[model samples]
Target: MAGEQKRFARFFFYLRNLREAALHTGARAEEAEDRGLELLHSAETEAELKKLEEADSDTLSYVKRGLNRIAFGAVNDAVKLVFDADNMTARDIMGMDLFNVSEIKISGKNVLEIKFFDRQKALEKLGELAPQLDGGGESKRLIESIYGRDGDSL
Candidate 1:
């Protein structure tokens, strides 16, 4: 039926958007697709669109947290600690907050290499989301909380 087709079209639209959101928040390709499919399958009613919108907000928050961790978190000290294997124990390595790290490898000559998520890309994504977050709504409240009513600070 035409109605069913239209509904399915709308569902796919939301799914695509959610998947892009997940990717912008630093999810792997497969992970983003899975999240989108899960969210689409979970919402069976028009009213459930609200839940999808809430999920977008959650994704934005996740992106922001990742950006901050990469930009301001203790990467320098963490890398130093990692390189100083003699001073670091397994428990210390396990306890480290490496949320900003993307990859770790032992390279040629036993060189330890660590890769971090791209901070510039994260900032660019946040810039893209800024206009959406500035629009009046829950996103506006989030912006206000972070940057203040005058849009100063942070």
Candidate 2:
């Protein structure tokens, strides 16, 4: 009778853990969907939408692996909250200091106009490279190298 009771207890424990994992997965999915929709609505161009889709795909794959690890019970309690919103959320991506950001306006499709607080200073600093901003081959290569084909790091 004692052995049977022990088995039942162990079964319940596993059940509870799996339930928690499911809840976590659902919450993350909801948050991701909300943020994704917001990004889509704010997107001005098809290119921007495509970029968001690519990011979503990468994030989905990462989350799937993490969830699989959880299912196998290989994850520690501390790691369970790795995706906690407070620790690291989609909002964190745009958590820039308001003071440093003077303005963010959509100038046109596939274009975002961001004005920094120290606009004059910024222009002054970039004055030397202003000529290169005029579609210089060096500038183009530099940007392409930093942001590869899919805008993923090279």
Candidate 3:
């Protein structure tokens, strides 16, 4: 009887300690979760949101910079196209409303921009230089080849 009582008492003591530890751990976890959520909420800003979106989506800013640098170099080599070198920049095209080369700057940088006037010419230029932005043409061919003649799956 004494041995049994000692065993029960030891079991209760261990159980009580386990329960206390579990409660403290759970409370700490909940507090950490709340702090993480608060940090996420605090990170809400236009610039931060843009960076997050660019990281997730196909912003194509790097592609655009490469294209601009190539074009600028080509222009300097081929023709004496004069430009305010001091004021030369690459910006995003806000909308492709019948503009040859329009710019739209977001967060002091360009995210999505298009430099095109016609379909064939744009395709030609894109095919020659910025093939990544040739989504309309190459994508169509790719989708058609993959999805089949129906084009419904695309």
lDDT, candidate 2, at 110 = 41
Ranking by TM-score: 1, 2, 3
Clashing residue pairs in candidate 1 (N, C-alpha, C atoms within 3 angstroms) = none
Model 2 lDDT, residue 137, Cα: 57
Deviating ranges (above 4 Å) for candidate 2: 1-117, 136-154
Worst 10 residues of 1 by lDDT: 1-10
Report the CA-based lDDT of candidate 1 relative to the real structure: 0.58
Using alpha carbons, what is the TM-score of model 2? 0.20
lDDT of 3 by residue, 1-154 (tens): 3333333233222222222222222324336334333323342322444454455355553444334333321121111112232333333111111223333223445333333324354345545644455445676677789998658985
Q: Report how far residue 151 has shifted in candidate 3, in Å.
A: 5.0
Point out the worst 10-residue segment of candidate 2 by lDDT. Answer: 74-83
Please report how far candidate 3 places residue 105 from its true position, in Å.
33
Q: Please give the CA lDDT of all the candidate structures.
A: 0.58, 0.39, 0.36
TM-score of each: 0.46, 0.20, 0.19
